[model samples]
Target chain A: MARFKFLVAALAAASLWAPGASATVLDNVKQRGVLNCGTDNTAPGFGYLNTKTGKIEGLDADFCRAMAAAVLGDASKVNFVIVTDKSRFNALQTGQADVVFAHTTVKPVRESAIGIDFLPINFYDGTGMMVKSASGVKSVAELDGATVCTTQGSGTEATLAAFVRARGFKTTKVLTFENLEKLFGALQSDRCNAMSTDKSALAAWRGNSGKPDDYTILPETLNKSPFAGFVIANDSRWRNLLRWATFALFQAEEWDINSANLADRMKDESAFVQKFLGAKDGFGKDFGVADDFVASMIKSVGNYGEIYDRNLGPKTPYFIDRAGTPNAMWTKGGAEYSPPWN
Target chain B: MTTLALRWVHRNLFAKPFDAALSLVIIPMLAWAVYAFAHWALVEAHWQVVGGSFKVLMTGIYPADQLWRAWFSVATLCAMFGAGLGLSVRPGRAASTVVALGVALTGVMVAVAIDVHSGMLAAGSAALGVAAWCGVHHLAADQRIVLSGLLAGVVAIFVVLSPPGFEVWGGLLLSVVLTIAVSILTLPFGILLALGRQSRITSLRVISTAYIETMRSVPLILVVYWIWIIVPLLAPDTSVPGLLRGMAGFALFFAAYVAEYVRSGLQAVPKGQIEAARSLAMSSWTLNVDIVLPQALRVVVPSLVGQILDIFNGATLVFIIGLTDFLRAGQMILADPQNSGRTYEIYVFLFAVYLAIGGAITYASRRLEAHLARGSR
Candidate 1:
């Protein structure tokens, strides 16, 4: 029995893992003519598949599209793989997808040990709480005996527990659920006094609700979180290329360059916009892409501003204003500052 | 002649006033179901989009070049079922109605499915009807055992032939393959554990008990995760695929339940029968092979059928491991942005498939139980 099992195992291993799954993922994707970029299946501010449009629309979806545009030249030339928190890393490891834009926070445990590299942070967010105005729960400290609902298996659960404990608030209780939608429902149903998750998620959820005024998301960040994107580790070539490609959006936005009026702006010969769009800059060669790589990315998906507006903009149900968030341009006091284009 | 037909109805339906009242209520419910299903299936179903995405619905993201493997695999299973029917009594009118209903449903669906190019679908179903009629017309006793064995083997061979790959596997095909794989791989181990639990030796009993208890106590997800996580940690020689891990988890978890059922069958075998074998100077192995196992298996046929049903339903647990089973594929269709509002349509389609499968399993098990119960007298 053991020998037969061994024979089967050997055959299966030889069939699936040749050299490594990671090495072939990129070429396989290129040959397939669609970048199978991974993204969150249901994160509100990140990757959420819109039922109305039949397309995944969110900030994370934009990042995946941008990556596809950088690699394949067409932003729409991508297939989206829905990755959840538990299987997200495994999906990348097993060659199910080329990269993940699944709102995965960078942790030391994930970066080196789990075999995936984090791209630059797309959304600098932190945990926050939302409460009904009628609940009289003005601040985190004010809710001593109140039950707070949070999504299960997230850092929010632990943080809520620790905060309640350390503050010597004995009457406070924490509740956890598998999904934010259920957690929010719990809050709305008066089963819990407050709902807690990432601040951006809270913003999106509250805004997406038809009765947005019924709830309010507090500005207090319960915990610091940076939602970084990732690709399989051990491929520095792809890593460097993806990182610079993302930063190109930040640089474009900082220089007031967008999809609309890019040509008109480019003819100014400011050298920065020209160099950034790869008119004569030597950066694209360093990344093994065309000289106009960033130009292709911006042209296809538009600058980061345009992508943001289309997905999570104030005009949408989420109605998010990007002007004050850390996702704003560096010159405007947000953290999306890019190193100067040569 | 009209009065005679009325008399027959009165005898069957109005024999009891209570039964007549119940039928009155049930008839409307039945009519409502028929009306609703027929109208939606014909008038409301968006067949144009569905027809266009036929290849996607069937093959998922599986590469077109490798789809031959899936087709061949499916055909092998179909042939096995066809051969299995050769061993049994011809289906009665009730059984034939189910078969006819399935064929008719498929016919209506295919007709609606293709807008401009529905070529051989209705004809293909008609051909299947003819083939099934032929099979039911000719079946034998000795052929039954061979048919069942081949059915099992066909499942095993098809799963193995999936080319050490997952791309050719998707949709309902994935569900059927995983269920069969679990049942086949787990059967022998289940037998061993059952025998070991019934063994006179203390060590074997203790080991078997521990295994059965541990497996039955844990959730299916935990076992699946163990296969994914622990195999890489402990086994230097094996790198388990996600689908294999899923199947192994299902088998290990379900084998315990199957063993208990088998053990009950073993206990049902009379002690006198074993003593009689021993008196004839038969070894334990010979006695078990000749006398004990056959009777025990016969006694447990219904229970084994029940276990198979459980295994079929349990196949859905593979979705967490990222293998697209039927339910997961249904969910994937909903992932299309355009199909978002069509949740009711998609879910109704899934409900129909699951209902058909579940009904068949339950009906088979009940029939087996009725047959087994007769032996007690």
Candidate 2:
């Protein structure tokens, strides 16, 4: 029995380590006719599985479809690879996924050391605190001398301690747990007076709680948390294609070209609008993708506002307000700016 | 009857003043706890959530059209399990009665939980299971043939399920697959490592010692993550599926601990057995294979069963590498904002399932241990 076992083990190990040829991610994706876009399958507003339709639907999911539409002229050509927070970077690095949109925050160490490049910021989130509404705490100032809970080793802990100190709360104690579930449990059990994390995450937790209206997110922002999609380093062709595809979503919103009215706008005589929609002398040829790539994308997954309204708008379950936030359009006095299409 | 009951109560609970006080306090508390749990589970809980998410919880994100594949896999497993159990051990009347009651209760629960189509499929599978059990009982003399047939069933399941790619495997299906694959692969690797550790050759001993120590030192997560990352770098063209990589890492890591257990078993085997074989002019291979291993493995059957249980529980960790196991599937169900505030209900359902499966495995191991002990005597 022992000798036979040894033979089997050796054979299995040998088969796993066999040598094979490699190819560039761009070539592989093009040949496969599918863009493997990794996204979070558990996040509520950003990316989530819709139980009714049995399809992934959210802001991040829309971006993946748009990328596929831009590159392959069919939004359905995308394979939505589910990635968690820990595996997102590794998935991109190994060419298992072509692009990752797992709500990754832009950090200098990730770009310099991990060998990944971030596109323009798609969503700007910030750290905030939430307290039970019954406590009559409307802002961080009211939480002096109270225990606040966040995940251990997360940047939120340090940011929370700094905020408490700056406010001159001598008795404020910051408690840390290993994960969000425990932190929420601590707050629920009255072990902590408040919980601090990214506002988007707080919203999701609050939405999932028994009484969403019972909790209130404090007004003051503790820290910045701008998120963006990323791809592997040193692949300029693939990188540019993903970057421009993201930019096209915002540009479409700026040009008033949405999914519902895209065909009508295509008939406009303005040279700039015509070029923007890839009617004539389009810039898609310069980028090495399809000439009418943006048009295909808009037709499949609407403009940025439509995507937001479908996933995080007031009508949706998440109900995230984008009216006065940086996610709003530039014309509406928010920070969503688009570069020149010409 | 009243006099007898009073005597029993007086002896067990109220023999003295202190005993009476303790019984008065503890009995009511236990009764209240049971009552509260029954209320929450039976009446207050929203079981509709469990009913609605049943498919996703069974096979996450698998194509709806391909659901028949999952049912087929389940049917195959049922047949194999029935046949194996029928051939392995004979139970007395009391044990057989208990098993029958458990099966009847499970059948009633299934009929209540699933739709008509699924109930029909389940009934058909149960018929197949009954036929397998009867057939195996008649052919119990050819144990080798039965074992080979069971092994072929496992391979057939893999062939039917592997075509959809590892990414689509999620929920309970992923957990069962990972546990089975790791359990099958670990035994052979473990035996080799144990022999290497016990070898007379200096180089083999040192290398095996080093491998086992290194694997035992690091966390399972790091080993799994390293394999997930390094495999692609080593063979870029042939992308190994993440699920397979995770299974390989688990098998490798677990084999080390299994090697230690098997080594203890090897040590337990009397040195007289080997000396007797040598006196009979038996070769080392035949002596070890035909004599030492059978005894050693028999002594360690209980430990191997425990290791398999550990593998099943550890399957939940695959979510870190983006593969959803049973636990992660529950979280995914909660990820839908509409299912908010149903955390307790979802968690209660998951707990019930894990408890049921774990309890069943433990019961079988206990029975096996008893049977083996009887045979040795």
Candidate 3:
């Protein structure tokens, strides 16, 4: 009886860890005529479900539409599969989602151990601090003896400690709260001198605090947390298709070809522009899509900068300025770059 | 009348010095708290958040064009509830008042978030429910036929709602559907496990004990998450729907609890009843079914009803697997930057709905206890 139990346990473990049969995701998606794009419905400006429209509206959601347009020739042919922080990777591993764009931070262990490939970074996020405007503290360098609070058990706790130690602030005390709400409350009540978290979140909390001018976000970034989308590993054919589809958005922005001007650029006399837009000859044949797949994506969701502006720009409530951030195009002295379309 | 009211208050409030002092301090504070809460709820709270996101709160991202399926499913559910309630004993005054409050709240919410078509459907569903209740109550319908009919209604509702795909079934609708599915599916499996544990056969008893013990010891989230991950790994070719997988996890975990409840009921059955059935030379199946089960289930009816509430609350944990339930839906609404400051309104609404449903269940359980106890007494 004991041995029987042992055998049962072993079988269960074996089945759970066993490798699934690989099928090319591109073929499945093309045949299905719908792209299953996984994303979070709770992350504002990334992939939130807009209650008024009953539609997911954000940067990540537009990318899904763009992918659908590229692959199926219709932007509305995509189904938005809502995934949480815990289940995003499993959604891809189980073939439930063709690709995921859930504001996931690119990490080394995730790629190495989780059997998924990380795509190009879409947004650059990092730890940032916020202080009350009345305190008159300008930056991290001025908080020599101040107390800093962060959400407990988050990576920000360690980031805060390392920064304080490196800056040689002997009297700086670090505090941790159970959540951001409590951490913010502590800051408001003057229980802590500063509150720190992701820069995007810092901006959001400040924007929604009813009196946005009462708090000032410090002008120092503690660490890099570049966000990227991902897909299942060992499928370069599907991976390459998604990689270039993403790059096309960046390249379009670089070439000043937004949705508003796409038509004019398509009719341009330059052979390179025509070839790049798939008007005469294109890279789409090699990528297993239509010759004008790039045009379809741009037409559906616009260029990368436009997507960023639409979701996280000054018009939106959670606006984080992209003027000097790494999210800007390379030509504007930022890191968003695409290889030449030779 | 004034003198009598003063005397009554004096007798209750000033029976002891400490009691008088406590009443003096507490009554004014309670009144103030109630007034402040009323002021916030009525005057200060932004209810537009709830009105604006009513459809998403009710059905999540269920396509606008396919809302009729959800409405039809809701109508069927209302009919089933009405029929079920009619088959049971009539509610006491307290239960009636609770039901009236729930209905009034629902009416107010619907009026606030009114769309012409949905408003018509809501009225139709309530009418259908009332019609069902009247039909069952006046005609003296057979319980067995009504139960079988209700079962068919569940299947019909699932058929109507599933074609739009399982992924879109979310929000409060998802919570209710998942709760009902898990509650119904757990029943037979739980009974079998209970009987197996009480069986004379050693291997069967051991297996049932091991399963029940193992399941009850683990947290519910682990079971749900592992089932979600393992189903696809075990059957890599065919994609199992997430809603179905979530339901399976809930049913499996709750079955053990149901088993324990049923086992307690089984033990409560008198030894003499079993002896009397056996002395008549009745087969084990006939004895257990016709004799023992009725008594056992009667003793356990209140507990089983309470378990339905447990399942409803536990249904919220399905968000880990990406199925947005009622609580998750509210959170999704708050995630919108427009609704960010309306957290209190959304949370209060969710709290009121949960409290109403939970109170109704508790009232039903109390009524069942009284109803079942009448003959025994």
Top candidate, metric DockQ: 3
* Docking quality class, candidate 3: medium
Pick by TM-score: which candidate is best? 3
Report the lDDT of model 3 for residue A200.
80
Per-residue lDDT over A1-342 for candidate 1, one digit per residue giving the tens place of the 0 to 100 score: 999999877745532353254354455556677887877644665776443333567888999999888877788987776666777876666565778898778789988666678989887778888999776666677877888889999888888887788889888788899898799889889999999898877876676554666786654667778888887776777778889889899888877788887777667578777877876764777676677888888887888888888766766555455565676777777788777778
DockQ values, each candidate: 0.13, 0.43, 0.60
TM-scores vs. true structure, each candidate: 0.68, 0.90, 0.93
- Pitting candidate 1 against candidate 3, the one with the higher TM-score is 3
Best-to-worst lDDT order = 3, 2, 1
User: Cα deviation of B127 in candidate 3 (Å)?
Assistant: 4.1
Return the lDDT, model 3, position A30: 92
What C-alpha lDDT, on a 0 to 100 scale, does residue B376 get in candidate 1? 62
Query: lDDT per model, in order?
Result: 0.71, 0.83, 0.87
**Candidate 2: clashing pairs of residues:** none
lDDT of 2 by residue, B1-377 (tens): 99999999999999999999999999999999999989998998888888788888889988888989898988897787677666655544775576556555556656667676776676667657655766787666487788788789888888999787778998898898788779878998998888789887899999889999999999998998888877876676787888999998899899998898888888889999988999999987897789988898888887888788889998889888888899998988898887887899989889989987788678667867887788799
User: In terms of DockQ, which candidate is stronger, 1 or 2?
Assistant: 2
Q: State candidate 1's DockQ.
A: 0.13
**Steric overlap count per candidate:** 2, 0, 0
Give the least accurate 10-residue stretch of model 1 chain A, judged by summed lDDT: A13-22
